[model samples]
Target: MSVAMKGLRNHITPVSKIIITSRSKNIATFGTTEALQLDFLPKEAFWYFFKTIAFGSSNPEEEPKLAAVCMEIAVLMNGSFIGAHVIGGILRSNLSGQFWYTFLEYYRYFTGWYIHLQGEHQSDMFKKRSGLTYIWSYKNWSAVTATFHLYQISSANLNDLPVIRTSELLTRDIKLEGKFDALEWRSSVPPYYSYMVHHEYGTGNNHDVITAIESISFTIDRYYRQHQGVEENLRKLHRMLLRIQAIVEEAHGRQITNQAMLLQLRMVRAVMYRGYYFLDNFRYRTVQAHAQDEVGDRSLGLSPFSQFKRFCFSTRTRKIASEVLDQKELQKMLGHLENIVSDMQEFVAFVSCYPRMSRQPYCSYLLLENCMFGRQIEQEKIINFLLEPNHPSAKGINVLPIIGPGRVGKSTLVEHVCHDERVRKYFSMIVLCSADSIGGGFLTDTGLIKHRNPTSTGQSLVIIELADDDMDDRTWTRILHNLRGEHITPVSKIILTSRSDKIRAFGTTEALHLDFLPKEAFWYFFKTIAFGSRNPEEEPKLASICMEIATLVKGSFMATHVIGGILRSNLSAQFWCRFLKCFRHYTDMHISVLGEHPSDAYTKTSGLTYIWTSRNMSVVAATYSLHQASSAQLADLSPILSNDVLTGDVEPPEKFDALEWRSSIPPYYNYISHYEILAQPPDMLPKRKRSRSLSEGLV
Candidate 1:
């Protein structure tokens, strides 16, 4: 081989131009890479520490001479590793005609592919870098050994160089670069999760265990990292990470970090960069353009005899025969170069398939994903609410109520329900939100809010919102039109609110008035908020104040939120004061609106905003029965007044539309309603007269 390498001074083939250098020697002994200028390194430093291991350098300053000799002898015990002497069935089959014919005869034409696998080369070592747990044999020990030696030497200064022996390269001062342990890598070893990176960046390849030389590559090093103590092997692993950082930064343009993915991904990206650079920067992924006479360490295949020269001697040229060839010859060489590129791309794609086979991040967060369904009351209510619309029994037993004062939670309840995946999947899509609620997650500008991120243009949408009387009707109509576009699903439903009877003019969807909770549920729910438990006895007075507010809550989600905020504040007197004030405000607002008694007016007009005919008053009389209604009006009114239960033909009250929105009501409370207040005192129409008028109109 040495004689063959030396004889390479003659022939000048064009192949020599492609590879710049091919490191052949175990180059690490050169040590303290600081000896070389930083410019000597390649780009792609953003990866983690340890991806910078190059095979060996070309003799850059030397004149064109015989190239360095890199003899890669991989052992294939069974086609898996180089020779450990166990011929696995796959290799045994390869030993026959097909394998021998394909590789030995044909693959040699492909530079890196056809090498001697039949030969026996055996050398064993405690995988120094892979953790002492491994004992790797020389399957392709020559290249592996050379690589390890080169990096080991480069890492150490001249004073720290390891001596190479016939069988093994050993040093009293042990320093192992993790990148060389191929055995530590294989399929069975647990793969390391490269640290998280911004969502846009990801590692495209798995680490080649033998070649992965950074902190993120192995578990042992990471474990060593968590603690600083030196427990022999554990200590060594930690130091390996530090060295990896140095080489990766100094040699490759990588930024290693604990963030996980940066290291390995950088290396893979570098690999791609190299192919691109080769094909582009110098046409390396292609065939060489220069004549064989061109000298350098990488021109290993050019000389008829320089087959022995490797990357080690690929730097400066020593042209023996400067006489150039003609154009016809150049064309022939170019054709061959094109073929090589075709072969190389195939090889790169083959390596690319492995990583896709290994990703499982999507399905791993099962526990965390289920956290949204936490509270018992919340769960039941949401579920029942979802089922109400479709259930046959739900028609008469329906639950619809706008539980809010000004800015209460009625709309929020609707929003949460719509966003829930279960609810999202339940209906093709349901209209659970109101118009007053404008902001949503994936909406486009100009009110074109789409329900899903990657929605198929025709997917259903559930629009929820909260509206105020001040907002013009035109705005709500436009919002509805936008919601109905093909970009969103059909008009599942529409819910609106107004303080005046005229507002009933815009009732677009089936309206259900929302009233406050019953005193019992309120007692339990309020106690939990005010005293942090369902035990009302813990703070009876506070619970009492809350129950009273619940009656005033009038099914107002916003009011509950305000009261919830008050209780959460932990101030006793202030809470009572706020409570009393809220009731007073409710009373004052009522007086200023209707004539201080809504039920009297309810008997006159079944609807809050419109002038109900004598017929409408008959329906209103059935539901109100001449009593002042609290938030619990519906629940309070449900069992009583058998004949005329305001199952009227009119819409939900204009003043209290929040109570009517469907999606806002929780499921468990299948029934809730908030009849509009008249703001007028009870009228004194003779009972007999009022009864006669209502009955006559009904007839």
Candidate 2:
């Protein structure tokens, strides 16, 4: 089909339309620009179909009770018209309410049972038992072989999609494997579209870290609600939380693809989310106990209005305090979490830099391309500034700081401007070096370069490049003073590219903040890269998917380029759909790659917050480490591990132990505290005569 589409694209008329339909969305993209989607019938349409068949075209008003039941059954079917048709036939055979009600319950039980069975890996033979055996107890259903017909209908409606129970459907058809008949049978299960890209590879154990934090927060919240003052244990817990937060903040930027790191993260998240799950019950109980106490106080010598005043005032003025459940269950979980965190911190402190790959050196010269988006305006502004030397400076040297978020094409914009014919004619030498390459010896090197070039006194261009958003004002100022002294020429120029605004304070005469691609430009550039010359109108489905991808990235050119590269590898719509499902994880992975670039060296510096920014994403996270560890860089964490940073604190890591806490909670616990808020009447209470303090108004 793809080959056919390729041929058609070459030979077909310019305005001709071609349509192809396939079960696989990937197959639908063959030689197609647009894909038209057909949705399932809406409830109203399904209801009309049900009424005509179930009632033999009779008016539903005559049998309103049956009509109502059918309506409910339709809703339960989840827009499956085929289910309604088969079940409607059964109703036609027996018009009694009991029969219909029994079948409805039977259907629910069958589905739930099937789902439950699929969750386990049972033998194939055990699954093929006749559907009639379950329904044989019911009176008329057995006589008509109703269960057999129901099974047929159910199997026909079921598709291979894992949306509901693919395992059950697959198991039932195990005998027919490899046959053409089996292939047809397999199509019965519908395609599941809501699958998310597995994050195990990308995030590693970050989910565990986050879940643990949530559990701690839940416990802390509960503790404060119960107690009015800070306890020693509570303060200790808070300090531990702050430390964990610091580690997570630092680690969030680093790749967590290591197995050991992932294990630590998983254990921590499990212990925390699990601990919170059990401890949460105590929080509700504590709130309830307090509510009961408040209720008992209402019986004191106070008016109804006064009571209302007290309740409102106390609720408003309530402060969170340090009070935790003394239950061994909670203590056990908290202890486990503390140990996990301790180990995690130790791991973080000891982790070393990823071994650098020996790649070919990058070319000093810029290769400007016409396809580059959002560079024209920036290039022009930078070139105009460089060509005209009217700005005020100490020693005929001007520093223009180009500041913006990461991956905003600051380097590319400046590169294109440097490569311009006019820029080359105006400036003597264009030297681009990473900020890390600059040190105490930079002045001597620049002095040597200046002395060697004694023939020309024209302006020299020095490009100071920084990748990380961490160029400090003091560093920049020192560099500028040293830079001015090294040059023999009266007028020298410096173009500083950094993501931090700290450069602005030192010696920046002018700043150009590169903005992201505007909405129209972003879409145009994205579509061009994703589809190339293919008209999006011809393949609407692919176009739709591209739009979704655009939304996820929020107009990042680098992201757009990365997504385009991934898409170019495979043209299948299914591949594209799957990519879309896991697009966020992929996006993060790419941002991490960008952060590792030599130009963004700000990540290794101390006290600097590293932000992974796209046109739309704001991932500005503050990086921190163990307080004892002098260096904050993840690359230089070896010192921390050898120094016992984890044990240097108050206590040991593994004081608490519990096997039961490791076990997952019961599924039914999902619905324990599901509550609904009811609207109160305006006249429920009289207005208060005076505003009252929380303690003064209490009964």
Question: Which candidate number maximizes TM-score?
Answer: 2
Residue 152 error for model 2, in Å? 52
Segments in model 2 whose C-alpha atoms lie over 4 Å from true places: 1-370, 392-394, 434-457, 486-491, 584-699
Report the C-alpha lDDT of model 1 over 1-94, residue by residue, as the tens digit.
4464456555675223222222433333433342322221122231111111111232211201111111111111112221211212122323
Q: TM-score of every model?
A: 0.23, 0.32
| lDDT per residue as tens, model 2, 97-136 | 6556555543433333322323321122123432331111
Candidate 1, residue 300: the lDDT equals 17
Deviation of model 1 at 641, angstroms: 44
Per-residue lDDT, model 2, residue 232, is 47
- Which stretches in model 1 have alpha-carbon errors above 4 Å? 1-410, 426-450, 453-457, 462-510, 541-699
